[model samples]
Target: MRKRNVFYSLFFFLHLLQQASSDVHSISGYFLGSQGLNLPDYMERITVDDVGMYYYDSTMNAEVPCPEWLNTTEGQEHWKDINLISLDNRHRFASSLQSAILQFNLTGSSSNVNVYQGVGRCSLYPDGTLKAVLTHAFNGEDFLSFDIDTKTFIASVPQAVIYKRQREENPVFLEHLTFFYKKTCFERLKILLQHAPAVNMKKVPEVRLFKRTKAGSKVLTCHVTGFYPRDVQVEWVGAGLQSVEEEMVDVLPNGDGTYQTRRSVIRPEENPEEHKYSCVVHHSSVAGNVTKTWEEHSGLAAWIWISLICFFLAIAGTGLLFRRLCKTKDVGI
Candidate 1:
């Protein structure tokens, strides 16, 4: 599965490269959500720049072209003065049909908000002046006509064609770093947890297990969060503090400044009296071992009950034997 995903990503990037120099109007594609819904609402504009910037609502991310140097102090100050004064009117310039389509997507209405999770694409018109024919999956099965002047849809196309635009200069290493630093990591993480609480950072495993209540068998799930490097391991320990063997799953990176991992298994759902279990997180940097125990209720309770029962049994047996010996002695006399 890992290899397959890598292959698909490479293929998609190559396909985007080939589509760069063609002269066709419009392309159409679809996105399938987690539930396989062809949700148009989550569909934002498809951008084809090497920068691959997406515009969801009316406001465009004007910082796309800002170099990573602006990630520092002086660069930001310079950009504030230059960008606002000089380029305020046109951060998005449309010299071709593709550029026009891009600008239109960026200039959406207030009510337009969508979060897409699948695949989508568009074809552009090849005319040097301004002509793009493309298809959008969420809108309909038909290709939509893209206008260069107004940056809106005018008509639909019957077939997919090659739409080409002039290639801009490739971004330098600093540009790529800035792109990820600004676009992918932070912004995407915020989008993923759009429904979550403001303080809830989305990708941490945050594994959690409920209190064990029964006696025969029990399974607990714990949440883990903020794990980096994408590789992590989880283990369960018994009352004797011995490790138990169980199946494990591969951890996947969220790419948005967070990682997610999970561990689940069946064990003695320790009784309220003598239950004990521990969840340990294993990683290289952790000194010795990193573990959190949930014995506040189970392990301590069991130990206390066992100790009390043993004490009473010992006392009663000793008293009964002594009484029997005394009675025998008196009878003999």
Candidate 2:
């Protein structure tokens, strides 16, 4: 059963790789909320063509100067009001918000395009009160909570109002953002993806297997290098032919634009010889999956084997030489 599961996993991984390779465009965006001692809870930046198009600095309570292409008169005017609102409510609450997020994302393919936008705000007050709100623009969902029994509004309304007004005024803000991003960003990305110089390209992976001793235990590692697209799946199959737990390190970039990743599994010490391991790598560049089996030949073992072989050969040669000399002596006598 475990063997069957391993094969099924390999098959699914290969199918995923094929589908990923056929994809032409890739797009991703992130909205992160962090707590800082000296910084604001909310911040955002948008990039296009590898250039920053728009930035909002919550600490400064202002929108930084954008790229010329995005600095249209209308955009400037719109942000002016938004910035004013941000500044007005910058210090209204006694306690700062723990975290807040406002993010938008767009991804496109030949057949479909996906867009997502969301906002979330959470604040803790000095009077042991908490307030939070989360909104998803794509599905028109809003979640809010507060722990206060007073008439005073503990949270700011300007940011929420501005977002709501923007959505109302421009029903397709996500679509427009996607369109603008494609016009300014996707073109360059496409060119980079298609025309990556041959000198900077790697078509096949170089795989290596080795063992390391750490904390008196043996660790087996599969090192894969010189692969393109930066998305590769690696698995370790133990003696039972089941996928073993492995720790995969982050993928690091090579000087020539290829990528490298490492996966490792801890080898059990007891009956280590009875346990065999194999590393399987799946990449789009390779037609089929690559598998490498582990060998138990340690450096010391290899040296001992070579030394024994040489010693036996030396003894046999010496005996033959002595016999030849004795034959010569007998003939002379």
Worst 10 residues of 1 by lDDT: 28-37
For model 2, residues 28-135, the per-residue Cα lDDT tens digits are 222222232233444443321112223454556335543343344654454454354344333322112221223222223322211122332333233534333333
Superposed by TM-score, candidate 2 places the C-alpha of residue 316 at a distance from the truth, in angstroms, of 19
Tens-digit lDDT string for candidate 1 (95-139): 222332343363354333222122323333444332223223212
**lDDT on C-alpha atoms for all candidate structures:** 0.38, 0.46
Clashes of each: 42, 0
- Model 1: lDDT equals 0.38
- In model 2, which residue pairs have backbone atoms overlapping below 3 Å? none
Error of 1 at 98 (Å): 12
